[model samples]
Target chain A: MSIEVNNIHRIKPIASYIVVKVLEETKTTSRGILLPNSKESPQKGEIISVGPGKKSESGQLKEIDLKQGQVVVFGEYAGTLIAQDESSKYLLIKEEDVYGTYE
Target chain B: MSIEVNNIHRIKPIASYIVVKVLEETKTTSRGILLPNSKESPQKGEIISVGPGKKSESGQLKEIDLKQGQVVVFGEYAGTLIAQDESSKYLLIKEEDVYGTYE
Candidate 1:
């Protein structure tokens, strides 16, 4: 199945790649001070769609351990920016790039 | 079996990784002028040992396509430098990092 983000782009990840909806953090600090965007922090995103896993050397399609809607963390530089619109941005990353899932 | 380089380091690759013996290019030009080492060129190496292949999602070990003594090419920056001695240097690289084999 394909994931429709912002009801605009229908994306279907392939081969162990996953589509993530970047979860933007609150731009303001606890003291109500606006903070500039930082690239050093680990990126947090919600898995929109997971691919059918990568193929093994024997040509078998292995299943990925992740699922859609899981909030996952990844490196700041990981994944490729796929789509960016007014409201949200999307990234396409390999399953291995995902560090782990969080609450 | 482990591969020995310079009769000093015995390396055995693990899980889709391969030990490569870097083949140093000729330092002299056509006119016998010594050229400085360049990192822009693709590195050439001979496969010293191949890993048993990465395990699939089912935990089955797939077989690597390469074999020992085969000359392969890879990106200049690919792989990790595992060992270096007086006569030869060694690198540990994944099978996927190998571009292809040549005579």
Candidate 2:
């Protein structure tokens, strides 16, 4: 279990959510949550990876269908969660803390 | 000492920067820093505020000039800083963590 690749890849996690890492058990969401900063993260998880968006300014890249493992609900005050690992359940929210994406 | 206006003013905080409230005394330079989450917040403060645009998809609103009190550098992981105030400085980042705007 080793994965940490980077080629200066870190838009800093605002490329737009689609980050899943639960593997199983799912049910206890407040929806995408990430709001905290004083020096680098304050909490993390809840918005399981998401892509298909962000780059819109005419640079044209606007396309969100919420796929990459789906299961969202963000906006407890959304955006700002980083826990790339710890089996704590990978997280890094944005895309407006998702707030709407569920089955 | 009371200020908190809103018309559902909570895209969570991703409508694009421009939010000042320092009083007087600047120069810490960490740029626009924000990140962390698990519940609601993890830390907060540092991104005085800035905005000029962000609303594309042909709805046309792409302009990002970073004003309203410019002094940025967002990207300590880019975006997520909420403090509102308490002489605490007022934080709420997510303009791509601003990472470039200083003078």
Candidate 3:
């Protein structure tokens, strides 16, 4: 299942945590029939929400480098699985767990 | 083997990393023989060195709360094993891996 990048989310993460919606891949047959791959979840996703930042030892807030709506790739087993609804699954992960951004 | 807290270390860590010397327990037999327990390595250790701190996304350097000569406890499989010399083994780990400090 996937969510629109512009959709509003009710959950807010704290301290460098990010809310991500996992992107699912859709395959197509020669006849243009769509086949949903349910065996595995992709590591790529869109950032739905971002935290303010992690506090330094000196009590300074360091802002995260990422912004909402950006697509990013994370580690295979990086985040905790969370469900926003019965059909929508989100991932809560640290900004450091993001491997890179997709252009 | 354990190292003296006052001894100076030649290696320095970078980016919120910490260098720790694992403490070894020594037992005595009824006949007054000193026996070194070599079966398992303790998770407790003395902080030999610490990094400045992890850089914030804004490029600010935070200070670590720990200092040299302080005893700290880490996870059972938290750090990477490194050797300063033939008899001295040290663990290189992130500051976050430290569970607590011994007062």
Better of 1 and 2 by lDDT: 1
lDDT of 1 at B52: 67
Clashes of each: 0, 41, 0
Candidate 2 structure quality by residue, lDDT tens digits, B7-79 = 2133234457545333332222123222232333222223444555677756677655445554443333333
Root-mean-square deviation of each candidate, in angstroms? 13.2, 15.9, 14.6
* DockQ per model, Cα: 0.03, 0.05, 0.03
**Full candidate order by lDDT, most accurate first:** 1, 3, 2
Write model 3 residue lDDT over B1-103, tens digit each, in one string.
Answer: 1122233264456557777888754446578786565644337889978866777655667888999999998776666543333344466667888889877
Better of 1 and 2 by TM-score: 1
RMSD of 2: 15.9
Candidate number of the best lDDT: 1
| Candidate 2 local lDDT, A3-91, one digit each (tens) | 12121122223345444343333333467554344433223233433544667677567766666555665543444322233334343
Error of model 1, residue A103, in angstroms: 1.4
User: What's the residue-level lDDT of A47 in candidate 2?
Assistant: 41
lDDT of 1 by residue, B1-103 (tens): 0112353234445457777889987757679987666645568999878866766766667889999999998877776554444566666677888888989
- Candidate 1 local lDDT, A14-100, one digit each (tens): 898998888875434334443333213346688989998888777877777678988775556789887776788899988766544
**What's the true lDDT of residue A62 in model 1?**
78
